[model samples]
Target: MTSAAVNRRQAMGAGLGALAAALAGCSGESGPVRRLRLATGPEGGPYNAFGQALAQAVAASGRRIEIVPVSTAASVNNLRKLDDGSVELALAMADAAGDAVLGRESFPRPAAVTALARVYVNYTHLLVPAAGPVRSVKDLAGRPVAAGAAGSGVQVVAERVLRAAGLSDTSATAPAPPPASAPATERAPDPSADERPLGLAASVSALREGSVDALFWSGGVPTPALSELAGEMPLRFLPLDDYVGALRERYAPVYTAVTLPAGVYGLTEPVGTIGVGNYLLARADVPQGVVRELLQVVFERWRDLLREVTAGARLEPRFAISTGEVPLHPGAVSYYRSVYG
Candidate 1:
């Protein structure tokens, strides 16, 4: 063929190839896959176990979900991460969610997070070595205690209880006398010595070593570590019944009268305490479809989930909407109302 004919044929072939490529792009069958990220609490914690169960359910939905383990300061940090988009989902204390949304306590600004469900109730647990003298909140006034790690929901509640009990870090060890030359105005007001702040692990160690008098934990009933500790060491569960009225008056409405049943960990009697629910939270900006699917998976596979953790058995459909102050996510609301209503 002539040169001109050959050039014309090459140009036509190139145009056909470009047309094919465009058609392939518009096929729509080869779409990108979506992934859901769930942020769980520190290793071996209830939040972590719950998160793993949730991730499993989501994965079983024929969708992709990844459970990410996070060493958090508990509810506060979890809410912050969810708001900032660092995590799409997280577990938080219902009270903490309320506080964060209202910008109360440690929250400097309101967090843009929404609740999916109230998963389970967390009990305020005060554990002392079985052989120790610490028997109640009043008994701990001048004693060393573990108030939970900083940034944890446990720490916040523990501190609130201490303040309610008229105790402080310095309440147990203040010097007996002020300087002779100091002005009267400079005199300390009830200078009680400060108690050292111990983290969760450190508190456990302290108890084992007999260095600390007691440890305070705010978590779901039958916490694994607490159960394990009870088996290994003689431990006592302090009752919060005496201060229930005061605790309710001072804090959010999360605190409720409850009992730790006898034989939960071979206890001789049920421990009376105030309780709060644990909530599943998500960023306000998460795609509505994703949240809806996540909640759907949780409810649809409820039985399987119940087997994953002890707390799972408590996630009833009616209780899913049990959150008080934190507004339920619209997506979750749709799912809950469909099932419960």
Candidate 2:
């Protein structure tokens, strides 16, 4: 049979199976299965993969789940959406979670959310073209740079780093005063005139085109897009070891020193960096039974889930209680105690 015929047959078979399941439910008082909505990140992002794995595990338990794809903004957005009943679950960074619960930075109001588990550490990578003259963060002082997308965790962290270095986005864009009130023709353009803060894809494109000297991104090691970019243009991941202590002191306790291995992205040597853990968050008001069943499925089918997605490999049970600022949800607490205690 042609490929189209095979696809049509498969579709009909799935429809028949769904009809049978619906009829079976009508025959009993067990009621229809509850459906959960999960919010993930953009296409080809870690959150998207994690959501898919969780949805698959929930499906295996005879529950219905719909995973929604969202943009890669800061975790605060995810927490807010969950609190407002827009989404049942979300993935968030630990630092972002801390800020949200405390009503600081991007979160205008306090977010009442609880954690299911800690997923993975996200490294803040400062990358530059290998052929570029920029070697250190200091070298990027007057150079064109992509500070990452607006409202993204990467942009938040980038702003913090720039402030630590005594640079402000406002100052970077301000025009220098003319000497001694000289004529406008004698005035020079601002050194930072060409600088721009852009999205991840734009940053990569700028670097590839030799238009930007550096870019900062907070993500997991071996990001597929970064790997592909490295293959075409020589790239170097900068080490942030020198400022690790200062970052930890200024930020919450979520910051930690981490080492990225050599072979993960075809680098010749390990890269030392600073990172924070990412967590799964749910509103405090979510149904206890629903949260309990979700966590149960996570721990029980962890290996199978890991096999299905890259992000699942970071779902370690030991990290469930490792959140720094946000309080654990009562539902998550119950599940953790039953499994770990």
Candidate 3:
């Protein structure tokens, strides 16, 4: 062929290749982006960190799959987002997820979802001033307390605990957190400026200034905010073991017994508390292959996930069957059986 013709042909080929590459950006007809949108907890929360970690690991593998993490209110909120088709992977508390699956209280109808993995236990912490007179859950009947913000997992669980303690219609929910738990990246609105989400800082501040007698928080042992609370002031964690039976009887079997060791938060004594299982959740309709691959990224590279959020290390193969309330995603079950068996 003539030299000029050959050059022209090569130029055409290059242009066609570029066009094809641009088209490949989307799956076509399915969605705009290929990356799965995962709803995690609010900024700085463990769920947010865990979701980002999983995304980072999967992207590093050079796989076609990509994960985009969206910060959410965690647990119950995550489930709601998942149900609305706004997100795919979500981190939720077993209790909340169970309610949705069973089509019971709080959820008028069943939400279509399958359990991913029971990630870890969220240890409930009821913080009271060491110098204060309140020593137990029942002690603060009419006293003001810092329950969590609206629509948050904290708020839901706190309400349940309060009811279990027969302290319903009492205690006040903190409007906003103190400065400590507030994110530096985003300044919280002034309590007088506008309604704001209640957080650890608000609760801690309320507890410190004697506005609230106690606060209810749940997270891994040595919850960062509570840890800081201990350093700044003498704090005591109220034992919830006494109410565990009542909580389980009234709620579900997701509640288990756990004890926080001494020195975790500078406490000289261990405190018994009811532990709730935290699970990774996915919509029931997610492609089985995609779910299977994501599970691989989470479990196969377990150490990397753990590094991102230490609580994730607990997402082991043996505990695959721990989720009894919400049914397991077939993809996850298949993956676990192949490995565990």
Query: Superposing all C-alpha atoms, what RMSD in Å does each candidate have to the true structure?
Result: 4.9, 10.1, 9.8
Q: 1 or 3: which has the higher TM-score?
A: 1
lDDT of 2: 0.73
Candidate 2 residue spans exceeding 4 A from truth: 1-31, 64-74, 170-195, 303-314
User: What is each predicted model's overall lDDT from 0 to 1?
Assistant: 0.75, 0.73, 0.77
Error of 1 at 316 (Å): 1.9
> Considering summed lDDT, which 10 consecutive residues are worst modelled in model 3?
188-197
Clashes in predicted model 1: 12
Query: Residue by residue across 68-101, what tens digits does model 2's lDDT show?
Result: 4454454656777777788778888788788888
RMSD of 3: 9.8
Among all windows of 10 consecutive residues in model 1, the one with the lowest summed lDDT is 189-198
Which parts of model 3 have CA positions greater than 4 angstroms off?
Answer: 1-33, 170-197, 307-313
lDDT of 1 by residue, 209-247 (tens): 877788887776577777778889888888886777776
Q: Pick the candidate with the highest lDDT.
A: 3
Candidate 3 local lDDT, 56-113, one digit each (tens): 9999876668899998778777888888899978888788888888877667888888
Q: How close is candidate 1 to the true structure, as a TM-score?
A: 0.82
